[model samples]
Target: MKLVTRAGWGAAPSRYDLAYIASTHGTKIHYEGAYVPKSLAAPGAHGSCAGHVRDIQASHLANRVENYSDIAYSAMVCPHGTVYEGRGLHRQTGANGDQLLNRAHYAVCAMLGNSGLVVPTDAMLDGLVDAIGWLRNGGGAGKEVLGHRDGYATACPGDPLYAWVQAGAKRPDGTAPQGGTSTPVPSSGGIARYQVVINGLSYGYGAQGPHVAEVGKALVKAGYGKHYQVGPDENWTDADTKNFSDFQRSLGFTGTAPHQDADGVPGPVSLQRLLGHLPGKTVKAYGMLPFPGRSAFVLGKSNPAVVTLDNGLIRKGYARHHAGAKYQPGSLFTTYTRDNVRDFQRATPALAGDADGYPGPLTWQLLLS
Candidate 1:
């Protein structure tokens, strides 16, 4: 990951007061909070995240609303796997609200779009992890990795990114897919989920199926499928295991056991990270898993998971009751949520008789998928 210094990018002179605060508690991930098309973000585009860093600074200076000392983030991650320095590692940011909170952690903003608009590409996420690693090792930062919403009440980083963070934010290069593919088959380099179930052997060595092939695809995307000298196949060989293990090591999941070890089994967390979606909480379900700790939810409930479920149902074509404007992320469960759940349940053959207007486990699994 290459970093573009402020000077290297020809940033304007400072306009506000700057504070010198060393290492922060951890890092808070952020997004642009508005839809930014890929066309605008493509590498070398005049509107790419790299090109907009200075525009953001100018906005901060003119938006009197913030009038921040400088750019609001410590660093920014561009879509093309590049890091551009903002206020550097030592300065406080206007990202976290109060000055006290600003001192709590330095912020890193990924040039991401608003929720439901765009998902962070693996390259962008890889750049983010690399940036975080650099902060912890060389830029004077602690170890906790969190989203902007983790501290603030607003959903600054959005669901896809937040869920990525919640899943231990495992680095992409850390592990390989366990094995699965059920979603629409993606192009050679796209992330896909295949049908996979661990009976006893845990999909390793001799596993042969579309799932195994899915794992290989994920591995190659992470730059760890070197074992497949020819191409990704439905076989999990020793070479595949070794390369997969290297990925596990990268995700801080190293050990010496099967379930406990970061072996070839592409556990839920690791695989979800690699596949770019949350398939299940602990296992791969054919749908969206509930927010980290939610089992079920109903009307009047105010929780982030509720927002996630609401959005998941919407994505699955079950949000008809929401009218033109849908329930926003980070919103409380209401008629909109309940109706969406019931509608979703009624659509699935297996769930038709159980449309209870509540996001139960099975419904959540299918909805998220």
Candidate 2:
């Protein structure tokens, strides 16, 4: 158990906006699973998260493509006492096999692999203890930390590291470790699910219920389209299904079994797909706008004014949804909405008006300008 320290790589994102993606119901620990060299025990040879990042960058350059924007792990504890931040401590990353768990779990990875000869240093172990403490006390990670091998196939985090992590490190109250009860695994929220990321943002749609509105809401949240407000009493209509289906197709998805007729009725396959349990990799359906009859436009009426208005606003960066020709419910405003609309009006003088900056005809014209 030797401590090795190193310097920062200076390439990790400094802002939380890019760092935090989503929260985990729990946290999972991982080891690189690669063989660690004895040199890692040497004080001068210990590398920081930044050093690992450099290696990753070099690997990517050699491979001629980027595997990920940063190291796949959220946090990487070095052999020394230094904790190099890998991924942000807040978001779920793609380092685990449990798709649903990965979406909700904040993952932490240690640098050395635990294959056989790889030995984690004392400093790395200490850093792990500190991180677990922070997650439990400050980060709200109560009983929600697990190892990679808990639910997935394969031995991860190694036997020694896993045992060490499970041993009561410290309670939230700074009490001694209570090695009685096993730490609880994070809730999966029911069925396992996959996530869809569009334009670099993941829509938080989990594999839970299949309500069109809910699915649509997730799409909107993921920056895909507007919110969809189809009635829960009735199934999705063919038109509704078609619109969603078409959106998925645009994202390179194939066709599914018919689940609805001409009227807004949902069929089985459509319902299944809506639930996110459809077989294989399905294209993510963009959410619908939350306005009345907006989703029904293509199936019924075509309002060019609203269409152009929506498109213009989207072009001017006022709205988020532009996936389908029609708009969904949640396609209204973004966090920087006021600035986006105000800037559009301010930048163009031809249609100057002290409007509240809502997306309407006047706003649309200003946006066009």
Candidate 3:
């Protein structure tokens, strides 16, 4: 099972140190209890899971009523079987209603919510078992495993999860304790396969296509079509370029070298950020860069693909290891580059299992796309 440390996820520091508890009654299962985006469950979209946890922590901290010191849950489990440390071991959780209930058990939240991606995956079940076992063995927790609603008034951990709790939190292979009949785990199925790719050459003076119109429409929807005198159409114009440049600038692409460019030509990353959220379509740019084989990214090897990979990591906000003055990102595939790649792999669900600090084909495709 993959474990993502708080640092790996870019979590904010807690407002205060959490009070330590030697032991608890057991682990209490919790769910998001709201509408979760189906996009989050997509194959290559698991990198956003860390952002979700951070958002939860931000919300908890900003809640005037709860006054939570950090994220309410002790830890969070994603559908991809990755465990994220929240207010980790030995800390009192603020999720289970009041003080007494909080003290009684450590909290483990499934990324599932009431609406989208509600069904728990087999991997998710395994992750839950991992978290529960970790708490029991290392955190001094007892044998009891419970849903959030077991002692609280509100319905949490929802029906499916509550049912799982009642069945003694059995593992997917039925290895753990069991009680009532086991509930069949459902599939988390909202991945959009086809991605809209806007050709970079599709813009400028003579360029014209349905794709251009689509880009204009997306730009209008994203509030970046202010330069449009008449609105988006098939024919590409300077207005489209100006508006696209503005959109690119919004993504912090203000230069024109290596990978940083706000030249109004839609790059894969910027284009995806602009239109990836559209209901049923993922988005990318044309000229989809092919992955240079793994041999190109090794210690002491200097390749342009390394630059591309590093830039992708930088765009994904995973460049801290190499962003320092001592060793900046370049063509050389150094330890700094490898470490950053490892961090990216650890955060991305599809790549977490093979986070060996080396770029594989899947990792390359996902990072660039």
Candidate 4:
């Protein structure tokens, strides 16, 4: 039951906004409905699996929705027992034949089918079961795992796999492993707008609205902000300029002249640099520092880097001062965030030994996963 996260799969992002809200109705299974040689299904053959998804998305965007940002499946399982994240946790997928019906359930596609030549091995079946289990628990899915034929007028998920889906998509005992997220590295393409949203893609004096606030928040994250004693806000003042310029210069930028000193204006280059590593909980949100600075996240640190850790903690249901308390959005790190990071580190097998409440590179990777 090994799982490959979205980043691990090296997916090319969609050019469309993610607007679909997922349902808890259960999972619908499907297949590529075409032949893929067994060699593509070999163990660790992640390249083949990723390539297959990309090709399908190209077809889906061109023929299905004409501008669909991504592939139709919520996720896909390979014959090697690895699950590749597709549209991720939220966002409605374009799989269902009925556009309005796409909200009924999540989609899981096992990379097989069409020519009826590739058979699903025992490992592949177990992988599929594990994929369903992960989606059911992690992404708020229900228990009624069914094939595409169950809800749509299509002979999808294929016959043999369809029968397996009906048989509860159960795995043999102890066959599945927990999903994985590896250490962070550069993404394969341009940074996702969802990952970082700046107003008009830049910020300066007189900018107002959520985008201005986003810039202020980013400034706060970078250990800047001489004026945000109460927290960053939408109003752009001289303090914003000072802090932004300080942050810009900190990145090694030095503007000279009567109007020198980096100017505190967030052009595209500086703005992307300040986003750090914080990802929004939903689509189309303004972003933060692109690179959170070059330090390990720890307690007592009150910067944009803390926001990165806080976002991760919030996502896994471990954030908040106490039970039933909502996390203060873009707030400074508190005891609660630290404790949750420690708890998550302790819980993760790969990170159990390093559960010191200080989120390093590996911790961020796992949290993103």
Q: Which candidate is the best by TM-score?
A: 3
Measured by lDDT, the strongest candidate is: 3
Off by over 4 Å in 2: 1-7, 12-22, 47-49, 57-67, 115-117, 136-139, 169-369
Ranked candidates, highest lDDT first: 3, 1, 4, 2
What is the overall TM-score of model 1 with all chains considered together?
Answer: 0.47
Model 3 — TM-score against the truth? 0.51
Runs in model 3 deviating more than 4 A are: 177-181, 185-369
Residues 1-369 of candidate 3 have per-residue lDDT tens digits of 588989998888999889899999899999987545333554665776777777678668867799899999999998788899999989999999999999999999998755434567778888998998888878998888889988898668876777878887887788774445348632112111111122223343345777678879999999999999999998866677678778866765454221124546554445546665322133234213444334446587554456567768877788878545744546678888989889999999988998999886567767877
- Candidate 2 lDDT for residue 243: 47
> What RMSD does each model have against the real structure?
17.2, 19.3, 14.8, 19.3
lDDT of 4: 0.59
For each candidate in turn, the TM-score is 0.47, 0.40, 0.51, 0.45
lDDT score at residue 188, model 4, on the 0-100 scale = 21
Shift in Å, residue 262, candidate 3? 35
Compare candidates 1 and 4 on TM-score and give the better one.
1
Ranking by TM-score: 3, 1, 4, 2
lDDT at position 203, candidate 3: 40
lDDT of every predicted structure (CA atoms): 0.61, 0.44, 0.71, 0.59
